[model samples]
Target: MNTIAHSTPVAIASARTPSFSPWRCYWLEAKHELLRLLRTPSFVLPTLLFPPLFYVLFGVVLAGGRSGGDMGRYLLATYGVFGIMGAALFGFGVSVAVERERGFLTLKRALPMPPGAYLLAKMAMAMVFAAIISLILAVIAVSLAKVSLQPAQWALLFAINVLGVLPFCALGLCIGAWVSGSAAPAVVNILYLPMAFLSGLWLPLQILPAIFAKIAPVWPAYHLGQVALKVVDRDGGGSLALHLAVLGVVTVAFFVLARARLSRSQ
Candidate 1:
């Protein structure tokens, strides 16, 4: 009886343990998240195609024809920011809301994996999408638009896009935590489009009204856009330290809010 009891406890503990190592669990989660978004046409098509299409239309065809390579280089930075914004917002926002509604989060919570693996997976997935978008914009800028830059500039701009996705990811997490799945897309779009425009992702802020230029700094996208513009020496004379500080604060604030809400729900 004693032997049976001891073996029974051991078997139960083994059964409860996760088979995968910690890093492996995180990797698998991220892999599946990327695959899931890739398979979703609504997500994949727009995230991958829209920025390039917009760049081709505005940056390449029109702007390149008018202002020559300068416009292309400018738009390259802006549109790269735009592409990453879309990827991070939709990827984190919609997926989290839907998964939460579907009880997937609860299921994962019951599993034996690390508590942060799910969120970390989503973050990694967003960065991957951001990287792809950045590369595509680089190709379009170099080949079609013929915009030239120093090697370090190109590398810096790409790094900005990849890391810049984090703020939007945090904002998306905040929206997803607070809103229902059905409303998540609408909520994101409401903020995304307006912010992009006001931040001069489509056109330069100098062309916009005075008020918009004044208020542009309030949006995290504007700060990111400025940092990106700095890479090409086209920024609006804002301090790099100021932009980075604003972005850092925005990221931390949204992430804290989202984490609090998620913990409450749990």
Candidate 2:
């Protein structure tokens, strides 16, 4: 009884341990998150490879002759968007659902770390992956596809791809909060692939039946693809403000919904 009594305080004190510094704490959290995901081959391999492979096949190798450059530039933007969406959705959605199912989220809450650090870390990881995907696509476009663009256009497209992960991250968070670990992957794919195709990421919306073009705006990926396409001057014509507004609303709305679901879970 004496030993048990003595150890209890130490455990409590450890649970309430002081962080070294707030900024350092956040950095460590994010660093570890990146490391953890990097070690997961299932996530790292597909997230990094699929986009570039598809870009190579459909965007470059299949470019046929004269229109190769246009196809390369256009798909570079769209596939970059596709790559980031996977990073955000899988990085957050499947992981969050699994962690929650295993009570890891609750355990984190019980720790002395900062609350936002967990989320911020995931977001940072997704952004890093997004930047990487964009870079790889850019390199492929330059070397293999023979695609060229103004330096400003390159930088702008990179910015759009990196920043574009946000709304998808929010959407993923919502999925993670609502679904079971086993179901999250299936749910994300159901939403991910169809949205990508419907948004004209795989094929131009013009050739799709007219109905798809009419409803394309309903999907956030379409808006993102448009903004990215606009950077290359291939977008199907619309106000840039409108795309930004839809993306902004999506980011805010899904985040709010996820937060509500998470809070209730607690």
Candidate 3:
């Protein structure tokens, strides 16, 4: 009775003590997360290689010598947008799903890491990959395709390309939160190819069926393509404000959904 009484207060005190600082815990996890991605070639290789190959096959070889300057510029812009989507969807989304299934997320929760840092690190990495891929495509466009844009144009195009990934990143998070690893790639492909095709990333809007052209504006890919087209060609036909607004809305919506889904899963 005396020993039990003596230990009770200590147990109570320890229970009241904080286990870990959220910030420190998150920082450590974020570093590990980044390292995990770096070590995974399945994630890195497709992001680095696919865009340029798509450009070579579709933009150059298939496009042949027929497209005018505006059409050529549009192809580059759209393909760059396509590349950004690949990183955000496959690289981030599938990885998150796999991590969740593998108990990594559960481990982080057990450690009580700061929620924001883990997500911020993922977003940061996605944006970094998007920027790097965009640069590579830009170089390819300039070198092989002889595509040229003024400095301001280049800056605008790059900005749009980077910003365009955010909403998709959020969407990827939602997918990651919901799907299993085996199903994730299939879901991503179903979403990716359709969005790319319908949104005119595979080809110009003019070349697409009229119905698709009419509905393209509703898709995030279309807005991204619109912003990219505006920058690459220095055209201002589409309302930049509208594109930005739609992307912002989609990002917020997907993030909210992802958060809810994650909480439920926990």
lDDT of 3 by residue, 28-82 (tens): 7667766777788987888879888888777667766454555557778888899
Show model 1 residue runs off by greater than 4 Å. Answer: 1-20
Off by over 4 Å in 3: 1-31, 65-68, 234-236
Displacement of residue 41 (Cα, Å) in model 3 is: 2.3
Query: If scored against the real structure, what TM-score would every candidate get?
Result: 0.92, 0.92, 0.84
Best by lDDT: 2
Each prediction's whole-model lDDT (CA): 0.92, 0.94, 0.81
> For model 1, where is the 10-residue window of minimal lDDT?
1-10
Model 1, range 177-239, lDDT digits (tens) per residue?
A: 988999999999999999999999999888879999999988999999999999998899989
Candidate 1 local accuracy as lDDT?
A: 0.92
Total backbone collisions for each predicted model: 0, 0, 0
Using TM-score as the yardstick, the better of models 2 and 3 is: 2
lDDT tens digits by residue: candidate 2, 60-166: 87885347478888888899999999999999999999999999999999988889999999999999999999999999999998889999999999999889999
